[model samples]
Target: MANNRNTSFLSDPALLEKVDKLRDLNIGQHVPLPQLVVVGDQSSGKSSLLESLTGIPFPKDQSLCTRYATQITSRRGDVDRVDIRIIAGPHASEEHRQHVEAFRMPTPSGLKFRQDFANILQKANEKMGLRADVSMANGTVFSEDVLKIEVQGPDEDYLTIIDVPGIFRTTTEGTTKDDMVMVRDLVTGYIKDERTIILAVLPSNVDVATQEILELAEDYDKDGRRTLGILTKPDLVLEHGAQAAVCDLIQGKKRPLTLGYFLVRNRGPNLESEDQSELDQIFRTQPWISLPQDRMGIPALKEQLGSLLFEITQREYPKLLQDVSSQISKCRRDLDSLGPSRQDEREQRSFLTHIAGVFQDRARAALMADYNSDSVFDQVQLRLITHVVNITDLFSAEFQQSAHLRHFQNPELHEPAEETVSSGEDFQGSNSLGLTISNLQDLLQATGVNDITQEELAELGEIIDLSHETTLPSDDVTSWIRDTYLNTRGMDLGTFNANVIATTFSEQSRKWGDMTKVYMSRVIVTIHRFIATTLRSVFPEEQSRRHLWSSILDGLLQRYKMAMDQASLLIEVERHKNPYTLNRQFADALSKARGHRITELLRPKARKDTRQYGELQNMVNLDDIAKAAEGKSNMEQQQEEIHDIVRAYYQLALDRFIDNIFQLAVDYSLLHGPDSPLKVFTQEWVINLEPEQLERIVGESKVAKKRRLKLAKKIQDLSSALKILKI
Candidate 1:
């Protein structure tokens, strides 16, 4: 019971202020406010029930029916009068503001009610600009505008309800079929709000299953989650001998909803002549009413509704925090987009600085690999220092260890200054001897010498080449014979293979260049979007912001191209020629690898080579030596040499390439290439502006201004609501 006492806290006047103010701010739009939505067929005692609840003297003229939704929101106040305040639809441009002010209905201090409800309705219709316009057949026949009736008194319950205009089955004289659709649509709109508790008022004279509103309610709330049934004409049920079924409905039987039905014999046409006390007495003691005191009459009805509202409020108050928070966040973004509303140039300059500093902070965070931010929109696909650096490291490791790199031309080895010419054409441990043999062959081919007779001519030619070579030792003679034998057979063996390795390596490494371009594009786009979004926010005026954006966008693009070209200029030097790289470690690694492969290939023929070569003197043909060569073309040996040379330098060039790529990406696309977003928004003279101009010249249009005010006010109202609902 003590825990149940918390319900009284919801009825606090502070909560009422929050609800009332929020209602006025959104004007029944945007955020869905919690309330009861009363639905019934036309003249089904909907108005009579509202009049009974409020104890207000509503007009008896049934002709002046409710044309729009009448939202009844009341709290316990000292005043005995009803405040009739009209909240026009958003589309009712002319009357929205004027009608929002409360029209107080004063009554003398007595049980006698004021008979001026008709005049008030007439005034409401006139204010809505709907005088006699119901008959006009222009298809847009109705409005979502609501007339709010606020009754404040110590005796009255603190409750909120929306009594929508009755559903119509047939077209009236002045109205077409559209009016029937209009009223239903209007009713459905209020009932559809999940925050609303549906009070479906079905007359007892009609079958509940046949009502279209009942079907609609069932569809919205399957198994009756938030719907409460109200049997308005209980007398008709008793007189017609259907009290047992009606009582079953009231006692939670047929069409059972989560909240069971309540029965009430409405004070119908004579509602204004009676007070709430008389109606209460009739409901408790009158046999004609024929309902239990707990489930019937205005008093029980008030208690049930109040308890239901408290239940709804308690269930949904936590969501109020979320709703208000979301609304505040959304409005803040919109308002930020509209930029700081500067009173003059000084504030405008300050605003520009603030936005610039904010962007700078975000960019620095991105550079430093901090991606977290308050704004949901503030995000990057990859941090410059995180993913890019990781990718760079990956590239370097893979490239350095690539199989394509066999070796490189060693700087440690050099060509001799002179060549030795002799019969002993020694090439053992000598880099220069190969050239001496080359000259001998050149002479033989050039002089047209051939056969045994030309063998002397070859000697003569070779001796002539002797002057070009230095002397050699007798021990080297054997080595020279083997060298001459090997050289005469083939020359320039591996030249083509080495050229191919260089070309392939050149081609493969260039792919990273294209990837660098793609990475740069992402960075540029991230910064570009950030600039446009943030700068547009500061300018506030759409037209001028767009114009400024377009102007600066062109300049930034041009600068981007220039920045890319500048970065490429540095990379272009490396692209044109391979670096003169000297990697000593790669030389040792390549030699060992090539030797291992050769040992594997030649191991099978080692025994045969030793036997055949040992018996070389008795050999009948050159086939033994030829076979001993074992496919070792001068071209292949040269190819192996070139492969080793290329392999050694591969790592050095790759490391340099990767480093250059990172530097280029950071410098050209991220830092000061096209002037960072932050710098672009806050710079000397601030681009496209004169010296005296403090900010971008822009205009705040009428519509933009209105939207700004509405959002701000709505935010204010929600802020209050959230504060009150915090408990």
Candidate 2:
């Protein structure tokens, strides 16, 4: 066996072998890999440096000066073997990718690497769609496809190295402007990876400051921390009169680097020992002898590069582990989102049934205000009960503000209107109304009636403010009512006709239909949004969700229409039906309104008689009050009574309208009713679905299938990578 000491000289063979396995797992394509990459201008001895480090001869033709990136990984094993493959680019066509994957080179006996490797590379080039015989104008000169070479033997040292396309400033006959930009971009991209240790190869004959690779290295690694400068072609140093600057670079007196520089000369196909002797002899005679001995030869350069790569890998191990774990988690989530394959009726039905179960559970929970059902329900938008309640409250308030056709004011009772304070101005003309709602208690003091509760007074106040802007003046209302009563009067004689009361109430409440229609439409829209959001979460697949939505849409629309029709019917009953209420609150409201009006009329007389009677109520006795009320014409008093009846009926109907619209129409028809939207997709419903219908609702699309397959492969590769990392 080869000496174990040789393997230990570079890095732990065990660790490098694990890294080799990681590379073979192909995880680097997704994340940055810990490796060394050699970059330089064209014809700058990049291949030569790679050959010296790995003891493998690469093709010397300038035409192959990195038509594609090359990844060389060396490992120790029982049998000497060399295997080559191509990793297709992310955007490579499926047909071309298949060809690239199937490409193989037959290893000759004894592994004559130098003699046959050139033919292997040519075959790979052609496989990548690049042909030497084709001109640049006719064929692609470069490929993003990576050519990977694995060499394993008992004598091999463990290492991984990559050679990217050389950076060039100008394009030649075989290259175009696009090719120049492509090569530059490729090289910069490789060095930009923080985990990669840059091997910046520069010819000794070139001006070190003018080298593009050094500029690029500085651009990515400004402190020169991960960069190692390698000076090649030292034989041409004296002939090109570049010795002074080259010696300055070697001595680290100019353009200093943290890892510093290495001076190496190509071995030119000679034996390793002979090449070492010749390189040592060349450096021993001149100013090069003063250069550090540790930085002068290929053997020393290899040790530095191996140790640096080891240090970087050790430093970046945690990050690599985190990256792989994160990728695994992401791939798993993607796979879960795609759900299982649904190629047949059984699978489709199974998947959809599961979805329906979850959907029904969540929807039921939201409707019942049981938000603890799932984490998704924690969001306010998903709290269906709260959303509905809030909308209902807003509707109630707006209807109160905008429902009335005209507000009543007593034109007969003359009194000073006190200034009224209001919180909001949404109700118009309320401030200027003759009666100030806040002072109602003061006026009622003389009536000796305190039966009206604070809640009742507040309700009355709100109605008064909202009705301040009247569509008809008080006299006009009284005139209309008197005329209506006279025309519709029957043989009832002294009593006003019932038809007059109903017609007056109906005319005042005409705004109910339009307002209720808008409210129902809003409720329908809200229900639709909630259902759509729920289905999206359940189905995940766009096509499946769409089909399911279309299937259920007809039922939802029908239910919504029913709810709207119900609301319209309620409005019609309020607007045209007979005005009647058995609730005692209506009588109480009527009495309170009458007392307020009577007090206003009696205030002027009461103040004048205060000197004679000592108190207002004591001065105005019942018979005296009756004789004063007899002063007005009978028709005017009846008209006043008509106005009060309509006002009381309006307040009563407003409450009923609000309740009927929300509970009977919205809640019953759209939310929790028998045919409500919440009940559209049930376990029984899904069970009753035909096989073809189930497939249509839950079938996996081709795009989804393709994505699922892709994610599965990614997860497999990442899992293998994790296992190797753990090892």
Candidate 3:
């Protein structure tokens, strides 16, 4: 039946591709026979079963027998013939090969070739009664070297047997560092293959050791396929009624038992003979399997195993095939998308332009809301100076009252005036000195200073003296005063104020202005720095956002690739000479062809020359507006350019956002087989822009006409991009 199916399937190219996909996904492998892994307690008749099945004696003793995992394989032509090989380890190297020779005694020494050398070491450890710790440290543990052996039966069927360590017995010594390392490596290595089935052997009688083995197995079996329980030492249970009671207890407790118990005697020569009557009588006349005597039972067990193997193969293959095909298809799609096609370039440009516009719009709104007022530039400067003077006065007064400065007098308030007795050079310098004093007074008044009365000035002098006279340090007072002043007044300052002031005036001509600019700059810069630095420190949200976006993009891309690949494969398969190989080839072909046509239609196209020329003309008109705005006063130019940049960015970003929304809506419709919430939203969407808002953004305040024109051109370009993207 399998041969007929293969012949038919392979004849069709499309069917062949599907089969290839399955193969790539490791899904469809022709497994004719099932492999059995036998594991148990050290003296639980495990070796006896191995001997019974393979007709080969396995060494049995109490001192840690089966030190290494053994594999038994049947000879290719002879179903009844078997071969054994040991998995190699670090110590199985040539240098240590001789040390293992003693264990393979009685077996042919010719088998001690390089290929068999590792097995010799394992066998030696088993026979020599090496402690698990020593063997493990020396790296001679059997679990570390899982064995594989194939057994060919007379019926042309083969059984591959894996003999692993009786974990129940091995772990009895208590977990050591070496044991843990070895166990970890063993479990990892054993379970690495999803197809590998685990068979756990347990005594028929219930015990704490058996429970522990089951628990350990459960912990390590990720797919839950490999761990199976095999009840051994059934003969012991038959001989003693207590054993039957133990089995009853275990069964009552609901212990997981996959395979039924095998009744076998390990210590006697009549092991091959069936004693069914005696075994039945011992177990109160219940049906039970008697090993060696129950030869017919072995074939039954093999048949059961064959069924399981077939089921697993069928379950895993198709899925694997589907996954591999999907991955390949996705890669092809991505390559196509990334190519320098005019459509792709147009799409990318459109997307970028949309994004830029959205940013510009948001920035424009923020700036307008923050900076829109009548004569705001001049008002901001005047307000800043007034705030600084008030803060300084308050701080000075606080410092004078502070305990640390109690001993010092204020020089400005207490110093005696110099007598004006002019010498020949002094007479000429008086005019310049008088002018300087008058100018300083005018500047102080402009900063909102009121005339200080002589009596109030004397009171201020007394307070300063009191502050200096105190025992506390002056540094504390200075710090406190500075903090109080900055905190109360500097908190309201904007980041651009100082830069604006500096740009407005020269350093030499306006000493007070420069001082004000420097101080305000420090304040604004410090506040902005604090906000930025604190956000980064407190919330790694930016990094998290990036990671989230990347993951989302990856998942979306993967799904897209899969769909494309499946579509492509579907198309390829329909073109086959023998379409009937797959039952649904015609339907798949039509669906895929329709999808491809739609995708082609959706592909973007670059703008035409006429459209480009129209956009350029719009841009030129906007540029003229900007140039006219730019020739105005410095303050006007700044405002106009700032407004233009902000608006342009906002428009660009908005366009991109709209485009994305539309794309998402389309994808949603495809996924759900109809329009979804996203589709509905896209359909109802409108880009709302208020004229009032735009006017607020480009304030009515006077700005250079040239700057306005420049800004207008940028806005036009941004709008053109948005139109192109249809956002």
Off by over 4 Å in 3: 1-36, 62-64, 68-71, 75-146, 150-156, 168-177, 184-196, 205-211, 218-228, 238-240, 243-297, 320-727
- lDDT by residue (tens digit), candidate 3, 80-172: 433334333433433333343322233332223323534544554554334444424444344443343434444433344556655543454
Please rank every candidate by lDDT, starting with the best: 2, 1, 3
Give the C-alpha lDDT of model 3: 0.36
Task: Give the backbone clash total of model 3.
Answer: 68
Go through the candidates in order and give the C-alpha RMSD of each one to the true structure.
17.5, 9.4, 32.6
| Cα lDDT for residue 379, candidate 1 | 38
| Candidate numbers, best TM-score first, in rank order | 2, 1, 3
Q: What is the lDDT of residue 463 in candidate 2?
A: 19
Please report how far candidate 1 places residue 461 from its true position, in Å.
62
Instruction: Estimate candidate 2's alpha-carbon lDDT, on a 0 to 1 scale.
Output: 0.74
The better candidate by lDDT, 2 or 3, is 2
Best-fitting candidate, scored by lDDT: 2
Q: How would you encode candidate 1's per-residue C-alpha lDDT over 1-727 as one tens digit per residue?
A: 3135335744454654566666755434666777788898876778778876765555545446778888776677676656666776655553466654444445443243335667777666766656445555432345566777776676666777777887878877676687788888788777887888999888877778778788888877887988988888765655544666676787676778888888776676635466656755645544435655577766677778877776676666567667778888898898877776654566555555565566566556656666675352343332434444433333333333331212233222233111222112232222232333334334333322122234333322321111221122223322332343344443444344233444545543454444444444434444454565455434546675665565455456655555455446655665556546556666676676465445444444444333655763322234443455477766445544444444445555555665665566455445645554335555443533552444344434566668777778767766765665564
